[model samples]
Target chain A: MITLFGVGCLVFLVVCALVVARTRDLLAATVVFAAYSLVMALVWQQLQSPDVAITEAALGAGITSLLFLLAIGRTRRTEDEEG
Target chain B: MRHVPALLLLLMVAYVLFLTMAEAPAFGVVDVPSRNLVVDRYLDPDPEETGVPNAVARIIFDYRAHDTLGEATVLFVAVGAAAAVLVGRPGPFATRPVTGTDDPILRTVARLVIPFVQVYAVYVITHGHVSPGGGFAGGTILGGSFVLYLFVFGPGRAARKLSPARGEMVEGLTALWYILVGLGGLLLGASFLANAAAGFPLGVPGKLLSGGAIWLIGLGIGLKVAATVANLFLHLAGES
Candidate 1:
């Protein structure tokens, strides 16, 4: 049962990662990346490492996304043109 | 066609991970090589020797202190680089500030919740020997609280409490404090970061002030992380 649940989560995580990579909208990608980190935190919790899980949740998901948003707010929201 | 190599790389990574996972010992097996004598040493004799009940804290701040010092230094350097780059060049962000939304709901909620978060952060750092939290976690939460304050009260008001220059000094000092604590061991006739062997009085096990240099190390790390995160965000947001 746990394996099934974990597999389901992994599948969802892969989809989220793909979306983040493929999407051109910077803000949308940032939001999806945050969701990916949340799933990663859950995976760490399932692996029984609460320390890493907490760090992943707080820094990886919360603070990192916030930082990206701050940077985005300062800079451009759209992707630049390729030469 | 464009993603062919990337897809192949991903497959290779998955294969490597599977191979690694296969090498791990079966779950619930205590006799595995991964569960070596070092684990036993920490579980049995280390607590008695160090008087730190939390094995993670002891491992990080006592047994492997040089690594912790390195980690703190890395954080310090990262913050310095961030501030230098962000603050040195004042771009469009400086002209028209992006943050500080005067939403009363955010202000009211942040005003109510920030104190508890900051207090809890302190508790986590102080009680690291008895709980799951440590300097890193506590410091991040503390930093988060500061960010909340910036969102609620705006950078103009927040600067009154802690200016960016002062934050740089604090973070640099905390990094130095870690080195000084390690050097204290040298003063005690032992190597750097020598916990019990360096004559540090390990108070009663599981006590708040116990764990000798571990708590002190945690304190330095906690403060350093807090200062770094606070300054990094402020600088990135063009407030500093």
Candidate 2:
């Protein structure tokens, strides 16, 4: 059951990564990248690396997302080009 | 064009992950090398030799003190580079001009959350001996609270609380403190960062006031890192 859950998380991570890469809208891509980090953190937790998991949660999910959001707020998104 | 290279990079990363998975040990199985070299020494530390409550702290501030110093230097350099690039050539409009409506709900939520975040950050820093978190982790949390404030209150407000000059001063002084500690060891006819040989008093184990130089080193690192990261974000926000 745990293995199944890990696999599910891995799949979600892959999907989120793909979404982040393929999406042209910068805001959407940033949000998807944040999701990717979150899922990756869960995968680390499943691997029983609580230390790495906590670091990932702090860095990957928290700081990276905050940085991305700040960048997005400063720059114009793809959709904003039409305006 | 950009997408092609990105996709190729992703493919490479996936391939590496697959290879790692293939060669990986079973879940919860400790690797032999780590078990023998690192874990063994820490778990059954020589009680007669180095009396420290946290083995990890002992390793960080004693055995691997030079590495910690180097890591702190890296943070200092990063913060300096970030400031140089972001703040040195700031235009007349570099100041973050507030242009948005201040939502009362958002402000209230931030006011509520900031205190808890600060408390948690302090807890993580002080309890590094008993928990998985240490200086770097706790420092990042503390830095994050400032980042949260920056997002809600704008860069100008955050800068008032954490000025660039003060941040730089703290970072520089922390680096100096680390070096001075190492020098103290050297002056004692021991190698740099020689915690045991330097005659640092190893107080009662498992207490907050114990761990000799380790606790002080952790505090130094925590303060330096928190200031460094906060300054980086502040400079970036100021530039934008």
TM-score of 2: 0.83
lDDT of 1 by residue, B1-240 (tens): 999999999999999999999999887677987777778877674478888988788889988898888888788888877776778687656655655877889888988999998998899878877677789988888888887787668777777678899888999888888888889999999999998899898998977889888988899888888888888877876675
**Best candidate per DockQ, number?**
1
Candidate 1 residue A21 Cα shift, in angstroms, is: 2.7
* Best-matching candidate per lDDT: 1
* lDDT tens digits, residue span A1-83, model 1: 16997998899899999999788778998999999999998898888776677778778887898887776776678886651
Candidate 2, residue A32: Cα displacement in angstroms equals: 2.6
Give the winner by TM-score.
Answer: 1
Question: In candidate 2 chain B, where is summed lDDT lowest over 10 consecutive residues?
Answer: B92-101
Candidate 2 lDDT over residue span B90-197, tens digit each:
654354433323989888898899999889888877766555566777888888988888888887788888888988898999889888878887898878777767
Distance (Å) between predicted and true CA of B103, model 1?
A: 1.2
Which regions of candidate 1 deviate over 4 angstroms?
A1-12, A80-83, B5-17, B91-96
Model 1 fnat value:
0.46
